[model samples]
Target: MSKKKEALLAQYAGHITEKFSETPNMAFLDKVVTGLGPAIYNRDAALVSGSDESELETVKANFLIKKLGLEDGPHLMHAIKEVIREYGASERNKYRAVVYYILARRFNKEGIYK
Candidate 1:
């Protein structure tokens, strides 16, 4: 939430919008990335008030599930792993990559990466 970070996330959101145009819900994607960018940057506080990594992942996963309208199932878990695999190469923040891919998939059912 600093102005600099906001600017970065805004720029990033725009990049994603253009780069992943195949994805339909640009607005939602923008929101997700914008909201998550801060969380990812300040991951310690973003994940949770506490300092446990497991708790952090749990909180992040739950947030993604609710935000993306996904349910708890094998498919969801599979998709989460796939998101990590596909986007993890370039993205140092696995949580950000996971959230990005998941929301991208939701918005662009056909495939956003294409």
Candidate 2:
């Protein structure tokens, strides 16, 4: 990864730490994101590559409905959809999608959900 990619992921990792109050190493986070199961795991590469809106949306649903096993489950995944809707309305869909994408990856990496 380039220095810039490293910096972005680092900043994103910090955001996750603040939200969850758990410290996960940057390197570990990267590994897990890259190794994520397919479906919602478009982010494994998207994180450093490019932030595609369509891919991010699928990534979001995949993480929630697939990887995290939140499929149709309530709480977190539902809440994330709400944000996705807002981002769409505000025309920030791409950025917010990636943000949520990063959070989902972080959650999986830290094994956050019960």
Q: Clashing pairs in model 1?
A: none
- Mark the regions of model 1 whose C-alpha exceeds 4 Å error after superposition: 10-26, 34-61, 95-98, 107-114
In order of listing, the candidates' clash counts read 0, 0
- Tens-place lDDT per residue, model 1, 67-109, is 5545566665555455445443554434453345454555454
| Reference-based TM-score of each model | 0.50, 0.41
Tell me the tens digit of each residue's lDDT in model 2 across 1-114. 657556655754664565445575676566544444232225454442123456545655765556656546456544565444433443421333244445565355346432
Weakest 10 consecutive residues of candidate 1 by summed lDDT: 44-53
lDDT of each: 0.48, 0.48
- TM-score of candidate 2 relative to the true fold: 0.41
